[model samples]
Target: MNGSHETEIRELMKSYFDGLYHSSSDILRTVFHPDLAYVNGTTGNYEHLDFEEYMARIDARTPPASRGDVREEIIERIAFKGDRIGIVEARMTMMGRNYQDLLTIINTDDGWRVLTKVFSFVERKA
Candidate 1:
């Protein structure tokens, strides 16, 4: 991947984490594709949500920052399959819980956008 292209992807990933930390749907809207489908399973059941559903959830919640949740993030890797495809692995703390996310990103005519997110809630040990 071109260095500039990689940089833009990194920036988009940063925005994603920041959006979760800040609970800013506007920021997330820019980073995720309109057709995004986010999947997660940790409560003994799987939950699937489209972009609008997830955004509405964000809109209803209190921002993690507002609740004094310290933001923590680790971007594990960003790998490219070609000019148009990239995969990102990352973890972040939000609302006092940890989440690991694998993002499928694609470069569209408009820009880089996250197409899908496969994630799980990480449980903290006592």
Candidate 2:
């Protein structure tokens, strides 16, 4: 992808995460594709969740937690396989620990949508 495409998608992704923490569900809808799926491993356990299911969980449990600014270090762009799809890997810091997120994105007629996001959690060592 070109710099403009990358920048736009990255910004939207950041906005997506921030919107979630800030309780702006409307903005959340902008980035997260309805079919998105996720999986994560932390402290030796792996877990998986699908999009609508995950959102239901978030809506039920998250009482609008505090959020810091979104800062991501893009490790690399895996490739844009076609006009419709792309992959990116980045490291994001939350609460002082770095979490790695991999995004599978699609370019719909409206713009880019995050089809899926897989993340690994990093615990802060004492």
Candidate 3:
């Protein structure tokens, strides 16, 4: 990966983590593509969402920050397919769940944006 690309992607992930922690769709919009695909299958049934649907869910949720939850986020790995495409593996804990996300990112005229997110999570032990 180009150093600049790595730096930009890391910044994008920071926005992503903050978005989830705050449940702020406005912040998320800055880092995600308008046509983003969101998918999950941890419950044995495949589910999919477009950007609007994902944002709606985010908007409806109580922010972890509001609940005084401790934020935990990690960028586990990053790899490039070419100059304009990359993949990121990330982990975060929020809302009593620990999540792992595979994010496909693309470099657009607007800079790096998450094109898709496929994620799975396990409920945290109380």
Candidate 4:
């Protein structure tokens, strides 16, 4: 694993977590590719959103920070298939749920950007 790539990916993940916590689409745009896909299958049916739809939803949401929700996030693992491809396993809590995210990233001309995010979440217990 290249140390520089790992560091870059870590920083990107941090930005991702912060974006969700703050519901900042501007911040998220820096980390997610324009054509990124957001997918979830926690329920029996599959849910999918393209980058635009996802960003719209984020823009409309009440940020967790505004509600004083405690921010929790962890980068469980990062693995690279080569110099340009990486996979990050992460966990975070938001919107009264704990989310497990599998993020696929690519080293683009601009930098490292998340290409796809497949995630699932479970409601937090009271």
Q: Give the best candidate by lDDT.
A: 4
In candidate 3, stretches whose alpha carbon ends up further than 4 angstroms from where it belongs are none
Off by over 4 Å in 1: none
Residues 72-107, model 1: lDDT tens digits? 898899999988998999988776578888999999
TM-score attained by model 4: 0.97
Q: Please provide, for model 3 over 8-115, each residue's C-alpha lDDT reduced to its tens digit, 9 standing for 90 to 100.
A: 999999999999999999999999999999999578847999999999999999999999998999999999999999899999999999999999999999999999
lDDT tens digits by residue: candidate 4, 1-126 = 889999999999989999999999999999999999999969874799999999999999999999999999999999999899989999999899999999999999999999999999889999
The predicted structure with the larger lDDT, 1 or 3, is: 3
TM-score of each: 0.94, 0.74, 0.96, 0.97
Q: Sorted on lDDT, highest at the top, how do the candidates line up?
A: 4, 3, 1, 2
Better of 2 and 4 by TM-score: 4
lDDT for each candidate structure: 0.89, 0.71, 0.94, 0.95
Model 4's lDDT to the true fold? Answer: 0.95
Candidate 1: give the clashing pairs. Answer: none
Count of steric clashes across candidates, in order: 0, 0, 0, 0
In model 2, how many backbone clashes occur?
0
- The weakest ten consecutive residues by lDDT in model 3 span 38-47
Q: Candidate 2: TM-score?
A: 0.74
**Candidate number achieving the greatest TM-score relative to the actual structure:** 4
